[model samples]
Every structure is written in structure tokens, then in C-alpha cells.
Target: MTTTLTRPGALAASGHPLVRPQAARHLTDEQIAELGVELDAIRDDILAKRGATDAAYIRRVIKVQRGLEFAGRGALLFGRNKAAWIAGTTMLSFAKILENMEIGHNVLHGQWDWMRDPDIHSTTWEWDFVTPARSWQHTHNDLHHRWTNVVGKDRDVGYNLLRMDADQPWKPFNLGNPLYNAMLAPVFEWGIALYDLELPEYNEGLKSKADLKRDLKAVGIKAVKQFTKDYAATPAVAMLTGSGKQALYGTLVANAVRNVWAHAVIFCGHFPDGTDTFTEENVEGETRGDWYVRQMIGSANISGSKLMHLMTGNLSHQVEHHCFPDLPSNRYAEVAVRVREICLRYGLPYTTGPLPKQVASTWAKVFKLALPGKGHFRKGKPASA
Candidate 1:
């Protein structure tokens, strides 16, 4: 059976807030209650601010994304012009990133539910991803955000391929994970598309073959639509105009850039050095306050400028986002300040660092955990590995 406890005592006080020791340890019930109340206040304040301003923000972002996409595709028709190819691919990449992160992710999270706009609502909005939005919402929003870092419950830990936690049984196959992780970056969406089918469940007899087949069909449909748009039709148009080869190459490159960047931003959120993973038992009888505390310790955040935050779809505030997944995306930065103050008052570790450092740390973790003798050993406590 999997262990059911959180080993907070294992953490050591690193200088960075990202690795501050024992952020969640030794909190009395009273303290947990107090923190919970304060957190609710922060959530409520952000909720209240979700009005015309938030609506306008999302609309404007969508407008910008559409414009960039149009211009990028138009420029790509100039195909063989090296400068146009470079500029168009870059613009397309940025457009894809904005659509996936700011628009698709947040919108599908129901962050814009208050607007009551069906066109933009989670129910109606499909993204450029190969994974159907319904499947993604279920796996990501319902499962991932709900479970956060609980070892057995959250498939997101290493995403069913990498052994993220050292305690996970290591096999010789894992030795190639460094390479696997690297390759995964450029094709991350494809990996996720396959994963969203939950094939493991069907193999384990937890899900039926019929259900898996249906899901696979859905994925195939989405994949065909995506590929036709990006790979076939767009380039075919250019080809007819004598720029086919360049458009094809440019779109492929742009997709690679968007995929890898998204992978990096997402990996930096959960797998970085200071982030904690929990045993399923740790959440037994968990309260809302306990859930909030779990999210705080289990997720790490990226520290960066406003543009960086926007580019990341404000997922730079991953901790804040996990804490209130349904909250308006734009409000996370504001809530983060209040959250840090609460963390200070309650002596919680508010883990955050610059983007480069965080991404590097996460990669270091991937490499280290791949070899897998043990994970970071904490002082005086049983090694989590």
C-alpha cells in the first residue's frame, strides 16, 4: 500500500523561498483555520474584481491572438523569402502560445464563466490541441487540480512516462528518461493527446475497451482537424501559390516552438526542486483548509515580469492558480501578494524563483530522478525515496 503521510520534516531550509523548509509542518488546527480564512478572503476579493475589466482582458487577448495568427499565415505565403519565413514563424509561434496558454487554458478552466458568453465558455470552446477539450478538462481540471501532487492519484506526476518521485519503482528503461524527456518537449501535445486517452486505465481493467476506443476516435478526429489546418491545408495553399515548402516548414517549426515552450513552463510549475509530492493517504479526511495547504506546498511558482506572466497565461502563479483554479487568470498576480503575506504570517514557504532558475531546477530534477538511487534526502526524517 502507498504511504498516506506527508513528510514535511524532510525539507531543509534553502535560502530561496522556493526551497524554504517545513512550510506546511507543525501547523496547529488553529493556524490552519486562520490561514484558510485569510485565503478565502483573497479568493473573494479576486472574485469580486471579476467583472467588465476581466471580460475585456480576455476579449482583447483573443483579438490579439487571432490577429497574430492571421498575419502569421498571410506572411507565410511569402514562403521562400527567408525574412518572411523567420518573422512569420515567430509570429505564429507567439500566436499559438497565446491561444493555448492565455485563451484556451483559462477559458476552458471556466475562468470566463462570469461573462456568460457561450462562444467563449468552456462548454463550447475547443482548442488547437489534439486532445479533445472535454478530455483535457476532465483529466486536467478535475483530476490534476483536484489531486495536485498526490502520488498515486495524479497522473500528471511525470505524466505516466517519467518517474518523477524517487519512490516509484525504477527500471532499466528509466535510464533513457533524460532522452525521453528531451524528445517530449517538441512533441508534448502529442504525448498529452495520447495520455488523455487514459489507456493505462483500460489496460488495468479500470476503464472499458469500448470507452477507450471512443476516446481514441475523438483524439483522432481532433488530430486530423489540427494536422489538416497546420500541415496540409495551410501549406497546400502556399504550395498552390509556389511557397508550399516554406509554409510547411515554417508551420512545423512554429508548432515545435510553441510545444516546447509550453512544456517548459508547465514542467517548471510542478517538478522543480522545492515542490512536494504527497502520498494518497495524506489527504484522508482532508478539509478545505487542508486542501489549500496541500496546494501551497505541492506547487511551485515562476517569478518573472508582467510580460512573462502574460506569456505564461499567468501560470507563473501556478501556486495561486492551483489554489483557485476557477478564479480569473488575470487576478492571480494580485492575489499572489496577499498570499505571500499570509504565508509569512503563518510561516508557510512561498516557493517562487526566476523562470530560468526554475526551469533549470526542474530539468535538474528530471535528470537526477531519472537515475534514481533516491530523491533529496531530508535531515532526521526517512528519505522519501
Candidate 2:
């Protein structure tokens, strides 16, 4: 199914303030309300069906991830050998990816909270990333998710660093967007840790000095633990086995691979060519339906095999994730189908593409926005299934 933009008021009649006459397809307020109801039903249906299968799926993935990490570390002890180094690095890379993406990310989202298990619960699950879990939840789940792509409202728009949207005032610092992003990718976890600190908020007097100090302390603790585990403790053990340097390098490369992959996946989700950025005024009087519409238009998806989807924590279904973020990641594939159908019926855009294409499009936008200009990237066309 496909949809296209219509002229302002071409199909709308409900004069709802939330209805953007300039939208890709003009939906009447009544239609938007109906869309919201359908989406709500999808959420309800998934919640109802959540059961032992979902529980088992998460448990199985966790077991595999743990086993891979154990084996990778074991292999690193023999890393003085060329084959051992390659094997350990490869396994460790996959381990870190699985842990960060499939397990840690979803667990932190509270996807398994329904089970009432404290071990895998969102409040207790500290992810492998450098950012403290609580800080990330505050900035990400609380702020970024609520704001999505609203220019100044969502800090994730450019993480307060890059000129991602033309609406974002251009500064001389923005000319370094490409370079900043290049550096950010390999150290993405570190970047996220710094971003979660919300330094800009502190500087602007929105955050209190005491709170910033507390958050900084938490980040310091988390960073120290991560560094010790990856760079110190593991390598120290391998040192006793005469493979200290090899083990250190293996962990270093594995972390870099995970960071780069994570950066790419996340960038593909929200910064791609077709995804829209909103203004604060656009969400001033937002309703349930309006919020759904915003998420649908503000995010893009990656189309690929199930493996690719799993690796991305099912964020390949970026549109669906933005809509029903608390739902289990394992269910996003099914949710995406219903969501796409809804988009077709309502003449909304469902922006999606392969990973490479999305990455190129996102980077292109970064470069384009870096220069001083009023030109905005063209709105995304509806993706065909």
C-alpha cells in the first residue's frame, strides 16, 4: 500500500488545530481520531497476547548473550595466537552487540516488567553502555520519547551538538557536524553518557547545580566500572596467561565495533531523509491521535531480514517503536504490519528503507544542514511494502 500528500484542506474538514493542513495527507479530525482508536486497539491486542512465549524469548536471548560473553573472554585468554585473537574479537563483538541491542536496550525499556522479575526489570537493569541506566531513562524514556523529534524540545534531535534540522539556528560550530559525528560514532556510548548529563540544561539554569553534580558522580561511577571490566580486569586476567596486550586490543576493537554499529542503527531510525522534525507549536495542543501522527511522521524504519531487525533491538520498526515504545521488542514485527496498514488507510507516510540507503540519506542531511541555508530536506514519500 502507498499514500501521497494532498493540498491543504484537500481532504480535511474538521478544523482540528492539531491537523496540519500542510501534512503529506490532509486527514480530517474525525479520521485522525479513528486512526488513534485503531492504534490503541493494536496496543491493547499485543498487551493481551503477551505471555510465556515473550518471556521465554527474552530469557533465551539473555542466556545466549551470556554464554557468548563467557566464551569470548575465555578465547581472549589465548589471544596471543593469531586465530585466538580473531576468534575472541569476533565473538566479543557479537556478544556486546547482542547484550546492548537485544537484551540491554529492551530490558531498560521495561519490556519485561510484566513478568515482575526484579532481575530483568528496567529499574535494576544497568546496560553495558557507558550511560547510567537511571540518567538515560530520564533523558531518553522520559524526555526524548515524549518529545520525539520536536526541534528544541527533544534533545535527541542533535543531542545538542549537531545541526540536524534547518529550523535549528545555524552556528559556526555546526560546520563541524560531519567531523563531530565521525568522532561520535566510535565513542557513541561515551557521547550518550555526556548527553544524558544534560549540561545545556544546567548551563541554562533549568537543572540545579546539585542535581548536575549528582548525575556527574553517577556517570563517573558507571564509566569507571565499564573501563575496569573491559580494559583492566579482563586484560589483567589474560596477562597471567601471557596474552595481556592481545586481550586488551580485542576488547577495545569489540567495543568500537559495537559503538559504531549502534550509532548507525540509531541514526538510521530518526535522522533519515524522510523523517520529519516538529516545532513546539505543532504539539502545543496535542492529543493522543496527534501524538501518534507525530511519531508516525517523525521516524523512519529499516527494512531487512529478521536477523537485522534483532540486531537493531527491533528498532528497525522505528515508527512502531515511537508509537508503542513500552511494548516488547519481539512483538514489533507484527505491530509494524498493522501500523503500516493504518498509514495506508489514512494516507500517511510510512518512511522506510534498507540500512545503507538510510545511513547515506541521514549523513547527506547532516552535511546539507551543516552549511548555512533555509533549504529543508524533502519530506519522505510513503514506503511501499
What local distance difference test score does each model get?
A: 0.81, 0.85
For 1-385, candidate 2 gives per-residue lDDT tens digits of: 0011122222235444542423534777688778878988999999999999999999999998898899998999999999999999999999999999988888887888889988888978888999998898888887878878877789898998888888778888999999999999999999999999999999999999999999999999999999999999999999998999999999999999999999999999999887887766566556677778888989999999999998898999999988988899999999999999998888888999999999999999889988988565534222220
Supply candidate 2's per-residue lDDT for 39. 89
For model 2, what is the error of residue 314's alpha carbon versus the real structure, in angstroms, after optimal superposition? 0.6
Best by lDDT: 2
Which stretches of candidate 1 lie above 4 Å from their native place?
Answer: 1-22, 377-385
User: Per-residue CA lDDT of candidate 1, range 112-171, in tens?
Assistant: 877889888988899977799988887898778877887788999888899777766788
What CA RMSD would you report for each candidate? 6.2, 6.0
**C-alpha positional error of residue 60 in candidate 2 after TM-score superposition, expressed in Å:** 0.4
